[model samples]
Target: MTENSNMQSDLQKDKKFQRDPHFISWQWPIVVLAAGCLLYYLIHISDHSLPKEVTIHEAIENTNLFSSERSRNTLRKLTKLGPRLAGSIQNEVHAPALIEHEVQEAQSNAHSSQSILLQRQKGSGAYFLGFKLGFTNIYDNIQNVLALLEGSDGNHSILINCHYDTVAASEGASDDGITCAVMLELLRVLSMQTLRLKHNVIFLFNGAEETPLQGAHMFLKHEWAKKARIHVTVGAAGSADVNFSSADACDRFVRRFHGRLVAACRLSVTVSN
Candidate 1:
């Protein structure tokens, strides 16, 4: 009886050893990783969430607001013209004409308190790209289509820039055409009689960006650049590339712009919900 009891006790110890092994288990690590991922997703997912879409009919009824459908239509028209390379007829002539037409259409509906001024600037200049490039880029008759919306106080201005030119063998719809379309839509919205502005706004549709920024250089030589307090260059959708002469100026503008954007986004989200 004592021998049998000792054997049974040894077997129970073996079973216990099998149940609780000394080796590390992967299950707990996997569970921890999954929990961490879930926590991260819950924390940061809102940044990736999209806003409610606006339909074409809703956009048309609300003429004073921005319309993605209208912008998309404009993009379609611009892209239908095909590639608009620098110095080409499509870039220098046709694109400018289309932009001018759009500006004129916006101007017709502009508020009585606002004045829209359009300029087709022609300029020639040479500038050193950098020591890395080790060459000077020269350009002549680089076209820039500029539209200025004079606000109640026109002493200071904000410049929004986008290029309409593309490289050879590419349609350049996403590269810049969409940005131009968005600018057109913004101009329309800002010109509404219901809205009031404290400072003037300039929309620059540069034609020589694919030529490596010659249009922007030409704009610096223009008298209008003097009044420009802020410069926002839109390379693509959601790209808010800003350039300023001073760090302090950029900081101030960024702070104000960020605050306004956050407020607007919150309002949109609340209204959608």
Candidate 2:
């Protein structure tokens, strides 16, 4: 009887201890502080925060700069033409004409120091996918719209490539039309008097990528291909691939380009704010 009573007493004491207000009071402050810290971290320290929305006036002012509005407009215009499959009228004739017009406009407005040369290249080639696949693709009269921006050192150049063609039944706005619009904007910006280049830049708007890289293969046979020391391919379906002659050159170019991109993003954010 005595032992059972002692056990009951102990149980009651433990229950009291478990329910102690002081213990909870001490823990509550700490938990609140932790939650507050988490909220602060999420709101201020994280890069995942949404960007501030830009007003119409701010967008209009930034048109001379890399403008999202203008890019979207260009994309809309391209996508409206429908799927530009390789060998289709949209891909071969209409798309090339539109891109050529844009490049020509940029060339006309280019700075005196910069000389923009536009080329509509037609060529034929065969590409073997791989030994394992044993697939050979042949192309005839594949068109490539190339714009060369001559710099001080014209002997060496960098090639920026993106295909304008898309798979059949797809609008391809995101797959390549957006990228084409971006390239157009980049050409316009680089042609400004304020910017000067040491090595030439060639923008290649390939028309037969859906035909499995036929346009690029055709470009390899072109005279301009000899001057290309580096290749930068931007595709939505894949990551950006930069190919350079040397690892050191690749590292230097990546670092420089990344820094400039970050700076541009910050500047855009500031302007929007």
Candidate 3:
């Protein structure tokens, strides 16, 4: 009986040892290491992720709002409004609201001392003309226009023209809106002149250069161009590529601006002559 009782006690002791959780082989070290590694990785990732470039028109294409494509489509879309008869031929013309909005915005960021209103009426028949653009302000008012007008006086009278208002309903990427931008850039660079200008520059931001040189014609009604000896009408040759420099258009512009087109914008020349 004593031996049986002792055997039962030994069995109970064995069962208790087996059921104790702490007595079993544990993996606390590995579990702790895994948690610590996960936490370390999370902290490292949080410290390493943050933005680099900032510009209003940097990703011009990526932004769907005012890209050049939008400008072109806007103009094409507006032709349905009604036909604007340029006397002989009738074509659809866009309104100036969108361009006006853009100009207003540009004025806010510009540094022009004299911002002016450029108005060119419709050109009469057989009108040949020239245009020059400098940097233009985005946001402006009537007073800004008036101030630009005030700065027109020089030794000789000349034309100061820009396509201020864009074509109505246009995503107007090109068709002279881009020209207006070129004009603004010109304005920014040209204002550093300490010497008096030779001609009285008549600043004209024609509402409809795309329509029919309307503003240019309006200004031409006066004897200013003839008096100022306006020999050249400068036009930008869009953009260029280094690889296709031998293309006809590029080659022609290079020769044109340097030789006979003295009144044109001087970009560069190929030959030493």
Candidate 4:
């Protein structure tokens, strides 16, 4: 090759190199800063945010009946089946079956358990009692459970409560199922313990608190109208939101029980009339 040809090649290479910029001045520094910020955030250092926590334990004690894994399994199964609305055929297919299964299992595990006793309403053209669910209405459903557990004693009692039915299209294992699992676990622990209580404890799994308070109205039907001297309802499941609200008797019970656990976590108080 001639010297001119070689020089032409060299010039072309230099021109290509010049056209391709190395560090577009601001781009490199900005990218570096972004990467650094990301790292800082992940590590939760210097105004950073960290990812969510993995479970250490149930965050409660003794009865680990409601593991997140088990609850998740229930959720997935319910999701596959779809929603569980009231007055639907699914009440027979899924809702009552789901709760009855739990009640039986809880009883087998030796908790001082109670069932709704499976009665029926003769009016309304058909039976209504078995059609009614447990976890629907908050205020009245709770009262009915209290009446069942009244056990003919004239004293106050501790109430453990949870709602079991899911919202429309919701496969909610965490929402209220978590609360049910918690109460079941607590009951299991208490049952296992040798200690006896002065006040009778009522375990309530209410139904249909989602829409109008039908279960509640039926529950308070002059029989359990008198509020339990103490009530202990939980936040909708999967929530550690142990708050007292001005909704019903269970709210008062929740406050009384939480008054003991305040040292473990800050208890928010709000009891309804």
**Candidate 2: where is the Cα deviation over 4 Å?**
1-64, 238-273
User: In model 3, where do residues sit more than 4 Å from their true spots?
Assistant: 1-155, 158-170, 223-226, 231-273
RMSD per model, one decimal? 6.4, 6.4, 18.8, 11.2
Best-first order by lDDT: 1, 2, 4, 3
Task: List candidate 4 segments past 4 Å from native.
Answer: 1-81, 111-154, 222-227, 233-244, 247-273
lDDT of 4: 0.47
- What global local distance difference test value does model 1 have? 0.81
lDDT of all the models against the reference?
A: 0.81, 0.79, 0.41, 0.47
lDDT (10s digit) by residue, model 3, range 1-273: 999999999999988767655553468788888999999998777545423232335423232123333333334443333333222122212334433343444445333553433332343334434446533222111111211222445445544444433334543334434444444433433333333344445444455345445545555554444555332233333454221233454466455455455543334321110
Error of 2 at 52 (Å): 6.9
lDDT of 4 by residue, 103-144 (tens): 455456543433222221111111134335633222211211
Q: Ten residues in a row with the worst lDDT in model 3? A: 139-148
Model 4 misses residue 177 by how many Å? Answer: 3.0
The TM-score that candidate 2 achieves is: 0.68
On TM-score, the stronger of 2 and 4 is 2
Top-lDDT structure, candidate number: 1
